[model samples]
Target: MRIVSVRTWALAVFGIVASYASLYWVQANTVDGITPPLVGNLPSIVIQGIGVAVMVYVVAQLGLRQPIGRQWAWLTAGSASFWIGSIVWAYYEVVLEQPVPFPGLPDLFYLALYPLAAIGLFSAVSAFGKLFDTRVPLALAAAVSAVATGAVYFAVFRTIAADAQLSAIEKIISFFYPLGDIWLLLFPAAALALTAGQLRGGRLAWPWWIVVLGYLMVAAADVMFTVGTWDDTYQSGSIIDTGWWLGFSAVAVAASLMLDVQRPRDTGEVAS
Candidate 1:
């Protein structure tokens, strides 16, 4: 009756908890209304930061091999690029356009922090995927996520931002703003869950599948919401929209942690 290390288990548990807590904070503070203050939202951002850190530490210790490392590097580099774009968008959205409290430090921090975190997450995912020989699927998923995010940026976000009526230099950034975010939140979440299953030496845990399904569901919901709001101001119907994204993200993090806890320690060979 072997048991998992307490530290490993705790990291997984707290990572999920912190992720959800951050989501709740965003729901409570940011999505309820427009003109949300960046200063006020700092705590939630901090919580997310904590969760990402714990997740990186846990996955890094899981013993991934070299090929996976290279692929993960690509993912990390792409995510960082996406987040840099996001920081630019945020500056335009919060600091430039809307007057928010404590503008200077918070703005600068978020701008820098997102890309850094993206690199960390990419490292974690690469290491985690090394626990199994499922590189093809993992690579395919990363590619698809990248393509989808890119499509959204070029086709939808850029056009909307470029409109003369709504035009701002920041809007040009709208295209890539959420691209890294979608990849970071989706692929890494799924990768962690799959890694957990492989580490556990069990029949592939269904939680990974659930995470993918939830992502699809949330994506569908976003599409529906977009259609419904076509005639209305995009900002008005955002509470539910943002809440749904955060909720699914929390669920993904929690499920991944649970799977990680249930995984067994490595024998000499990788677990099938």
Candidate 2:
């Protein structure tokens, strides 16, 4: 069990490092002095996929020995899965298809990915929500927000199909996309806060606050970029976009390390 835990941690660390390296390569090799839109996005997705795989392995290791470990393992693995889906969607939407390109078969796949990611994220929140008494409300809010966002996005899609010049769908999709992100933000923040509280109680685990902080930073950067470029082409050169991805990748690595460190000991003890 100890060996397995160590192996998982090693894999997580490797995944983090590898992801960052790939991202760095993408940034360094910008085409025509402009960061290729897809370049920035694709590496992140690949890295995240690697991170998710590592997390699943780690979770499996923990679950083998402890019952409660199974719950935490699932939560982490589930979140990773969602992250992977989001990464894939981003790759297809932002990287693969862009610049007046209508979403094709890939778009269908991309759209499907969002809901799956949403479900995985929700499941993770539910599994760990007890940490915060507000889990129920947060979960409900997230669900409602997701549905609302989806409906608005769908409406825009319909309008776009009906009349290419109609900006109503674009307007609606733009207005509510951030609202959808808000749901993503809430539950993770709640979970981190709960984990922080546990740390305060003398839990010797890797601080959940680290992951929380990283996630919040990423979310904030995303919001800023979304608003900043709302009226312009979604370019990747802005300090906010590039810097955000770099910071996000770094934080993800840190979070993976923290998870590795927090892996429960053989005594079956876990941070509450």
Candidate 3:
């Protein structure tokens, strides 16, 4: 128990330090060609990788404390998928000595995260039993998803599809990135509905909200990446790269917060 706590603190500290270092590096250096310096790539990869691993560990610990069934499995799997995908991306940057390919093997793993995380969050919420009504939340999720999809189509898909430089496959894969985000946002919106304007069980919703926030950051980050790519202005180690780490850090914190969940005893036992 003490060891876990210590390790968690250490990882948290590392995340903080890496974040500052990354920002400082970006601010201190002028644009060095298109690729970021190793300083930027290494810290972002190492810190975020460790952070996500820690979050997975925390989720696993929570499962051991209570009967979470496969809820933890889905969340951890989703987190792990992204972490693995990041590693593959790093391999291209670090080991292969090449630019990371767009819509390459990494996309398979990255895209998988959307479905996996959506299921994981849904399972986590449902595991609370029927304590909270979900009708409004469900509707809200659909509405938000619709709006986001429309915005993404107009802002991202139309441009990518119309680009004369991209082949059909490239355009199709580019579209998938934002499309996946639209789907991913629904899980958190539903969670927001369950937690909004309530106090009793709303505490449980914090982790969900945190994950939602993380995904939101991710969505924003990806948008910047896409726009940069489209305009031929994307830099590998630019400030935009910080978004991925920060987002994952939020996810790590969310996973850690779940450690305190009492695991609802029964629907009636929980306060309304």
| Top candidate by lDDT | 3
Error of 1 at 176 (Å): 3.1
* Model 2 misplaced stretches (Cα beyond 4 Å): 1-24, 35-42, 64-166, 175-177, 199-207, 236-263, 266-272
Candidate 3 CA-lDDT value: 0.66
* Cα lDDT of model 3 by residue, 1-272, tens digit: 11123343455566667877877776676454544546546656676777667766666666554545366566667767877887787788777878777768888887787788777666655654365576667667778878988998887778777879888887776666666666764545356536443644466566667677777777777777777777778765577777777777777766665554433331112222
Candidate 1, residues 60-126, lDDT tens digits: the string is 5433354333433333333233234334445645568653222233334333423653554456565
Candidate 1: clashing pairs of residues: 200-263
lDDT, residue 22, model 3 = 76
Evaluate model 3: give its TM-score: 0.81
Instruction: Please report the candidate that would top TM-score against the real structure.
Output: 3
- lDDT comparing candidate 1 with the true structure: 0.45
- Could you tell me every candidate's TM-score relative to the true structure? 0.45, 0.53, 0.81
Worst 10 residues of 1 by lDDT: 263-272
**Local distance difference test, candidate 2:** 0.47
Better of 1 and 3 by lDDT: 3
What total of clashing residue pairs does each candidate reach?
Answer: 1, 1, 0
Worst 10 residues of 3 by lDDT: 263-272
